[model samples]
Target: MPYAPKHPCTYPGCATLVDAGNGRCERHRIQERRELDRQRGSPAARGYGSRWRKARREFLRQSPLCAQCYVLGILRAATVVDHVIPHKGDSKLFWNQSNWQSLCKRCHDKKTVQDGRWK
Candidate 1:
């Protein structure tokens, strides 16, 4: 069988050649798919629409202290609102304010990665 014509991989700084119709090389294509799947399973995919945004803003307005930082004797301001237990696309769990906590960016990122929710 004839090999498909090749073109440069469209991924940034990549020097690999990919099939003409493909935007990324084989390795990069697989990486991209994994990244996309991560996003698809993220909270953003669970309808974190304007209502959620507004709720976050309001939650922060009411309490701007980082919950984790507070426990650690650090008085860091909260920059992100986090879900204590993952909602996992469940509307009831997602909207439960009792399950929410405020966190700083660093703390939120750490928790996200530790909980396998990082994209």
Candidate 2:
């Protein structure tokens, strides 16, 4: 029998379908894509500042599968480093690797809109 993606992620309150890429359903997948586009199109992104550019590249290089995707069994390409906690109050927390997670475009959007954590 062919493999089947598990329906309903194992995690509590997770809405992603395990089989879907990035672990999210179609809606979440679309959201992730849009978030990636916004990031790439951002003015700061275009500046090619050494810090920004290097961090972006390093983040991607360090992770392959989206962290959320992995949790739900979807292994899509990851493009963002998600912060576990918002960095607004603690700028020093921004650079902590333990605080970062890889996420596909879809999961990234879900996080952003749901909590505005990345904004």
The TM-score values for the models, in the order shown, are: 0.66, 0.54
Worst 10 residues of 1 by lDDT: 39-48
Q: Write the per-residue lDDT of candidate 1 for residues 6-102, one digit (tens) a residue.
A: 8899999998987777788888878987888886875566767788899999999898999999999999999898989988778898899999999
Local distance difference test, per candidate?
0.88, 0.72
* Model 2 whole-model lDDT (C-alpha atoms): 0.72
Task: Write candidate 2's Cα lDDT for 36-83 as tens digits.
Answer: 878668645444367756886888897877988898987799987777
Worst 10 residues of 2 by lDDT: 43-52
> How close to the true structure is residue 50 of candidate 1, measured as C-alpha lDDT?
85
Q: Global CA lDDT of candidate 1, please?
A: 0.88
